[model samples]
Target chain A: MNKFTEDDLKKELETKEYEYGFYTDIEADKFPIGLNEDVVIAISRKKNEPEWMTEWRLEAFKVWKEMKEPEWANVRYEKPKFQEISYYSAPIQKPKLDSLDQVDPELLKTFEKLGISIDEQKRLSNVAVDIVIDSVSVATTFKKTLNEKGIIFCPISEAIQEHPELVRKHLGTIVPTTDNFYAALNSAVFSDGSFCYIPKGVTCPMELSTYFRINEGGTGQFERTLVIADEGSFVSYLEGCTAPARDENQLHAAVVELIALDNAEIKYSTVQNWFPGDKEGKGGVFNFVTKRGLCEKNAKISWTQVETGSAVTWKYPSCVLKGDNSVGEFYSIAVTNNFQQADTGTKMIHLGKNTKSTIISKGVSAGKSQNSYRGLVQIGPRAHNARNFSQCDSLLMGDQCGAHTFPYIEVKNKSAQIEHEATTSKIGEDQLFYCNQRGIDTEKAIALIVNGFSKEVLNKLPMEFAVEAQKLLEISLEGSVG
Target chain B: MLQVKNLHASINDKEILKGINLEIKAGEVHAIMGPNGSGKSTLSAVIAGKEEYEVTEGSVLLNNEDLEDFAPEERAHKGIFLSFQYPIEIPGVTVTNFIKTAINSTRKAKGLEDLPAKEMLKLIREKADLLEIDRKFLSRSLNEGFSGGEKKRNEIFQMAMLEPKLAILDETDSGLDIDALKVVANGVNKLKSKDNAVLVITHYQRLLDYIVPDFVHVLHNGKIVKSGGKELALELEEKGYDWLK
Candidate 1:
């Protein structure tokens, strides 16, 4: 309203620095740079993993050695040198604290800067958090409250020691060690991630969350997460990540597997805001992840993600419906600005009768970045009366950016019903003028328009997450247009 | 309250409003009638500070202040409003929210706090009643899937809310039936006062019958060729625009 000219908006955008760009000076116990049999064994040994787990990682390492990096995504970047990445890195002194006051001050300050203060979150949102810093879980809050409900919530390493049966039963069942290139690599060297289990017929009273931070400079975060919802149970899990700005691209390859048995439901949400380097595309995180879930009879699985960071992102959180009357849903909003590139979407596989799936994806591309939504929906031969609906919309800020959609639908059953709709549009000058005439400046106008364009997916997020995601979208597109 | 002197404007090097001159005082309703390509909308756009048009030579002033350097929004904050002929459809933003943003933004420009929600809702309800608008219509996305008549009514509804010192209705009666035209004209009439003015640009004289402009001017080839009292509109209505050619 104070006459914010296009130049002013552009300048404001250029000055928008990454909020989570600070680095902590904690000493790291990191493995040597490079990926080999020795590195994998070292990571497994450092975790003090069991013999069977060690053997499983060795098998994954062998498969990863022979696999090739996927080149099918609609993105262009220099291939990451896997051999140059530190396979594992963690804080030298791990904190086994029972309360927030006992945690390290520096780590707590980092969380405060990221707006995930343990005390604040616990008092306000009632969300239990598992804080992971540099491939290790530092402190998990509200563990007692969760334990009272027969819920097992802790780091993966702790789970392996305390609840080995649950860890081993569903670790690689949905996403096996040989699923893909990144999954294989992550399976071989995953240092630490969150593990959640909900007992039979018990609904988790609070939202469970994991905050992942990559503090070390040259380390690659290979984290694996497993969530299991027993029969007639329900759980909602969310994860968030951020890293410091680096000159050399960092690697983040993660694997997450979810299992929901009969009459169970699981909702998984992610808000990823890793450092996306500088304006010239100098350095950022290269996030390549594989997340998938399995649904049994009358079970439901929903994946909602707001991806706004990473220099280059390649992920497809998918669902496999193997039981009758199962349902799968995906709602995503992927934003790319400056030199960032994102190729993220979902895959829904219908293998049983009366299966249903819905996919709503919104891609926003600004500056010179590229954003693509590549998804697949398949109905098998025995999937009688299956249904699938997909809507993909792209909003472009300037002429230099690009938004593309690739939807693959295959139906072997003649009774299946599938519908797909896609539209590509730019923020029109007329729209801007309309807002301008109404006394709204260009900056606020862009934010309003972009939020409106992404309302469908943003509405799918939780209340607090929706607010954060909206701010993230505004930040990502700042200075993207003049 | 508004003045346009020797207004020469063009877009993409093609001259549109060539040497147009106009003036409107407070408590007056003036209508500008023009044939196709006569630059009626161009005159309104140039006066509203649209950036696409290059002002070759001339000046537009509001309350004796030159408006050349003001952006469209700045002009709005300074009490100038243009009711667009085709309002943009912003999906997922309710009409109520859009208007709230506009009002709050203007208030912010004036260094004032946002209007209280209770007062804002009361004003909205009062204006909706004046325009005979349904309460449900205010909650729908702005102009998305709206009928043409509904869009015009919404524009006037906004004018009622903003209460600008100078309002330019560009082709407000183009796509409305007689009843819709009467409703819009009545709403505009209700908002008129001794301290503000209205400049109506239209191709038809039907709207003038309801609002009854004090003066009617014929714009031809980017110039006002004739000016007269309200009787001029009747004459133009009797004879087509070809008579002027």
Candidate 2:
């Protein structure tokens, strides 16, 4: 029996690797590494957008030029040279198809490598996916029924052409252009992403999902996603990201915005698995994203995420409770391994009377990984009877890995009530021995214990997605558990 | 069924059990009573192959086979059981799943076919009812958040399920109330047979009244200082371990 201590956990968490580092050998048309007015105009023209949409992009670009990169996050990185990054790249084999049958076979094979083959047995039957490869929406399934519900689900490019008025109404309503540095960059150059709108009083019957796979080398992906739930409507959305094996680092900067109007409800879930750099820290993905949502009077919005990839990740999905009796929630599990770094958490802004919010964050760090949780809870003067609760827990897989928590809470309304709690623990030898005595092996026991710790947040995901996320957690911690 | 000769052990470089000798035949029951730090539990831990306790100089024999060579699970597969003094909790693994895995692993080690799920379920139900345990308890995580008495009964339940040739109970009666003590004693008595042996290690004589050991040994300073019939337990109860020390 190996006596497990805090130090043993520290040892195992420090040995992470890049198993998905193999890249596809394909030709792609790409722009030069740099950002300028011409690059933005080229993207808008390539998508064949209307005049107003082009103007919107130009306006956002002007705002981005005035913003500075943020340094508030506890992350160490060589600032990415934006001007040296190609902002657009697309597989040359990709065909401009309007239906699933017209989609190219090679594109189908690409989704297979990502383990999501829409044509092969519909492994995710309950899920309707819109695959975004490089800088375009390759294929979208279950479109007709969703369309019948008055639900507008399509690529933002198509939305800009077909529903110009609606896109103009909510494009930057939740997250403005100058929200932050990464968001500003995303707003200025976001090439392709999903746009969904649930019409008033109509509930989306099935889960909506999308998969983002970055394949073009040196191309910085800027995908923008927007989901809006009108009055008395309900919807649940999920997004999963994976990249082909690549030795050279790929940059991914994306933004997501969600809005729930009066008496509406929305649930958003994400599973991020970009390729972390190799054991020697040679190459991987640099993921920087900003996601936010707003809940109106009698509205509710919940965010659940499982982050298990990226050589360096910096994201914080937050919620703004601005209407009376609105509610907000954030449940997240962020695991980083082998030279990976992450600074992620949530924010809850209480501005309306009787508003409520709940946040639960779980972080697992292994193999020289550095994981931090940064959150904010603010209660405004008008937020009478506002309440908030937050619980953050970190599990260290080894001593070399690090975990930290920084929570900011501000109260202005005397009637508001808030509570915060945090705990840090390592998987002990005694705990492992107890499981092994019952015949479970070391790897399985570690998986079970970590699953138990993250159960609260995992249960918030859609049933099918929750199971997949659990498997991802197991696979991500495979050799790290020992 | 079990034997120990010149069994010397230490923990963290400090000697806990000095030279000790003990033996038990099939169908026999032995009770060992001692004061704190007299190596009452050390003998059980050493025999069970807990890695922390070093066998500085010793030999443990089970059914004429050298027991010191096998791992803890190997000893279990060879028909040895140790009811822990304090059972460890394993969250997220149900008791039923754990016991089934244990039984199947033992079978696998013995080169026998694993029991089918149907047959195993039937076997579990019968043993659970005989021990008067709630069926729902089997669905909960193994020993997690269990009361002291519940933990003890769980140990007995596991012992019954395993049906080992040599069952060693280390202070199983310590934390139990009178009612739970009776339940534990009853379960152990039901498991006794002419083909197996039982060794009970305790610090009090109250437990001996129910199990009725054929022999009572007073362990002092890691060695058996006194050995006699069941009447020895009553004498020790009256005078206590001070005289033996």
Candidate 3:
């Protein structure tokens, strides 16, 4: 029998390539490098936005130029050149297609390879997908059901064209342009993203999802997503992203805003799997995103995310609980492997009486990656009898990896209650030997242990995403269990 | 069923099992008692193919085949089960799920389909009842926050579930209470058959009273110095291992 030593496993892990590294060859209508007032005007004009929307973009642009890139996040990388990045890029011949037959065959093939064809999704899973490739919203399925239920689901650009009043009312409400550096940049030059609104006292029938793919190199993807749940309504939204493998570092800065009106609820989920450079950490994506939600009286908002890719990630999805008896929840599982760095968590703000929040964050670091959980729980002075529970756990695979947790809790109310628990653990050899002595191989043992570690956060995911996330965790931690 | 001929094992350049010879046939139960640092646990770990222990000049054979290059899991698939003295606690993995994985993994190695869920649950329930374990304990995380006695019983529970051809109990009765010891001993006894063998490594003669061994060996200084019948256990209990040493 041939002996496979631990050194061989290490070598195998060092050579593992990104799974979704294939690129689409197509012509694109792209903007010239560098950004100015004219570039912002051109982007607004290209989208055929109304005058008020154009002015909003200009205002965001003016503030973005003055706002410096925030360095507070615990991630180190070469800062991307804003001037060298194309502000907007869209695949040509991707205009409004009434049916799949009119769509480009290559685009259809890409979606099929992505395993999320609109037809298959509709017939099998009933998930309506709005796909954005290189900043353009190409195809959105299941509109008839949305229309029947009095729901508004489409691209933000289309929403600006069709429902200007609604867009204007909620575009920059939750995550305003001045919220952060990335939010300002995204608001100014965002190409396109999904926009959804549930009517009052109604529940959206199916899962509304968006798949963002960065196909064009040298183009920064800045997408903006907004969701609004009317009074006594409910909706669940999902967002997933991936980019092709490239030698040059790519940038993805997106802003997402969600609103839950009185007596309404919103559940938002994200599975981010960008191309996280090669084993040597040569070239990958720099992901900076701003996502936040606002809850009205007697409303609820929940955010669940599984982050497994990106060379560097700095994101904090938060919820502002402004309603009495409101609830906020943030459940996240961030897996970093092979030179990946992620500083991701959430914030829950309590401003109303009897509000509650729960935060469960699990981070897994393998190889030479660094994974950190940074969270904040704030209780305002008026928020009497507020409660918050937070648990942050980190699982380290190798000695070369690092995991950190920085939790900030600020309570101004005397009646507020808070609880926080944290634990750090490694995949000890004793545990592996135990599993192996029971007939499980090393790879399967790692998978089992990882699944066990992230069960809490994985259980919060929808059925489809839970399975996918489990597989992703196993893939990310391969061979590093030594 | 098992053989260890001239087995010399060491960890970190220090030889623990200097040179040892052992052989056991089917349907036989052998107990090896020794004082502290007598290489009892090292022998079991080497048999189970733990990566830490290096067998300098040795061969552990299961049946007539040489188990030289098999990984720990392969050794397990070859029917070598080690009831660890300290079983690891893996949080969030339920006891039933852990056993199911272990069994299916072994089956897969043997080119067999996974045990069906219904049958798996049935076997698990039967084994749990045999070990006198509560149903609620089956759903809890494997050994997480479990009492010491519960942990040991859980180890025996796993041994019963796997039903290996050769089971090595490594100090499984150290922390176990009297009742848990009886349950564990009963489980091992029920699992024993004409096709299987057992190796019990303990420091005391208490557990042997419940699960009587056919042979008792005294190990001293990484070597089995004396080999005798079951009466040697009672004699050693009254006298001590100092005479053998």
Candidate 4:
């Protein structure tokens, strides 16, 4: 193990190539590289949206124009120039394909490289995948199979066209057009994302997923995802993202809203692996996302995320418990290395009697990165006997990294119970030596320790995705300690 | 099996082990008894290749090979084991998994394939039975919330599983009730073999009665001042270290 010194670890960590960094060379119909009311209107026109929808976009644009970029997050980077980003870009030759054979071979090859071959996935797993490239969702697999179970799974664009009443009823009910700065921008220029609806008293028979890829160089991916679970229904939705390597930063601002009616349940999971730039922070993605869920009486919602990429990440997946005896949970593991920055957590709002929420967050930072967990828990005046338990733990590797925790708890009802625990610790030398003396090398020791530290949250993930997230954690922290 | 020649070590400019010389052959048990802060633990740590203790002079050799350039893991792979006085608490890794990783890593270092799951389980059960460990105990996180006796016994359980060429027991008898001490001693005695050796470092002669040492050495200050047969431990117990000073 002498050869595996600190310097060697540093070199190995810096040199491990990002596996999903290759770009597909295909002609794309992209908007001009700028943002304005005309650009937003052009996006709406390209989608052939209804006049009401176009008016909604115009209203969101007006609000976004007056909003200032939020600076309170514990991250530092050059503010992205919104005007220099192309808001809409899609593969030029998008023919309506009925089978896998009719899909563009180049596009199919790109998904194959990402290890989600549509053909293979159809035969192997029951997961229905919606493949979104740049600003448009191109293909949705297992739609016929899902339609049999009375579950609506398709791209949000098609949902607007086919189920216009549902889309219009629930479009901005949870996250309004004026929710936040990035959310307003996403509402104005959002092109395409996944939409899922599980009917009352019917549990979806399979997992639903969306894979987002940023294929175009200068385009920003503004995706809007909405999932609605009716009374007594249950559905699990997964989201994943990756991008090609570039020397200039790319922008990605997304909005995700979930609605769980009486006795319904919704599980939302994400494994984000965007490009994290170079060792010197040359180029990567600026990910600013808004995700929130609403749970009605006797309903439940859970948010599980494994964030291992992005140059700068600012996200908070929140839940609003509005009905009596409702439940909400958030389990997350965020890792940042080599000039990466992440400020993420969750918010739990208890509004009714006997509501409950649990928050477990783990952050790992290495190689001059900064990771922070900022959370909020608010109990309303009428929320009698509401309960909340929050635990935030941070692990640091190398002296150059940083970890911070900011938790805000507000209890209005005297009977409400809230417990919060936060701990910050580094990988101790004694622990490393103990592993070393047991014949385990330092690199494997670090991985084992990290995996152990994150097991609680990883256990919350579904089986297949849990394995993938575990591997992602290992790869992200490879050769980070000696 | 192990030899330390004129070992001189220091930490932070303060000398600990001053010209310490010791040797132990296979099939023998040696006890090093000392008062508090008399450099007994320092010698065990230095021999185990801890980096904090700077060796100012002399050398430690295992099977006639110098261990100066070896890292702690390399030394462990070369068949040296030190049962820590206060075992580390790894909160999530179970005892069984920890031992499996240790065994497989050592095998990998020797260019061998991993032991099959069946064989690993069988070995763990056999060794665990010898130590009288509960099946449920083996599934708990390593040393987290463990009693002092359980920590010591767990260390011996690891030693029994690894079956190293040399095992150094550093204050293993501390914090154990009479029954726990007897069980731990019995476990160590059962594991002793003609091809391996044991070096026990303790402050009192209470543990020497159970796993009686063939030789006893008294360490005062930073040097060994007396060496004799097992009866020497009895004499030292009868008259405290004040006379030795």
Listed in order, each prediction's TM-score against the native is 0.96, 0.88, 0.96, 0.94
lDDT of 3 by residue, A1-482 (tens): 00121222334345456767888887899999999989999999999999998899899999998999999889999999999999989999747877788877888888876767788888877899888888888787889889999999999999999998899999999988888888999988999998899999999998899999999989999999999999999998988877889989999999999999999999999988888888898899999999999999999999999998899999999999999999999999999998999999999999999999999999999999999999999999999999999999999997999999999999999999999999999999999999999998888788778888998988887777676677667667766755
Q: Taking the true A–B contacts (Cα pairs closer than 8 Å), what share appears in each candidate?
A: 0.65, 0.23, 0.82, 0.65
Which residue pairs collide in model 1, if any?
A: A13-A479
Listed in order, the DockQ scores are 0.52, 0.28, 0.56, 0.48
lDDT of 1 by residue, A270-323 (tens): 999998878998899999999999999999999999999999999999999998
**Weakest 10 consecutive residues, lDDT, candidate 1 chain A?**
A1-10
Please identify which of the two predictions, 3 or 4, would achieve the higher TM-score against the true structure.
Answer: 3
What overall lDDT goes with each candidate model? Answer: 0.90, 0.84, 0.90, 0.90
lDDT of 3 at A326: 95
Tens digit of lDDT per residue, candidate 2, span A395-476? 9886889999999999999999999999998887766654544444566567667777787888898886776677667667
For residues B110-176, write the lDDT of model 4, one tens digit per residue. 9887777789899999999999999999988899999999999999999999999999999999999
Deviation from native of the Cα of residue A88 in model 3, angstroms: 1.6
Tens-digit per-residue lDDT, B11-124, candidate 2: 999998888889999999999988988998889878877777899897999989987777676777788788888897765566886777678767767777668778989999
Q: For residues B78-109, what per-residue lDDT tens digits would candidate 3 score against the true structure?
A: 99999989889999888987888889889979
Instruction: Please say which candidate is ahead in TM-score: 2 or 3.
Output: 3
Chain A TM-score vs. truth, each candidate: 0.96, 0.94, 0.96, 0.96
TM-score of chain A of 1: 0.96
Spell out the clash pairs found in candidate 4.
Answer: none
What is the DockQ (computed on Cα atoms) for candidate 1?
0.52
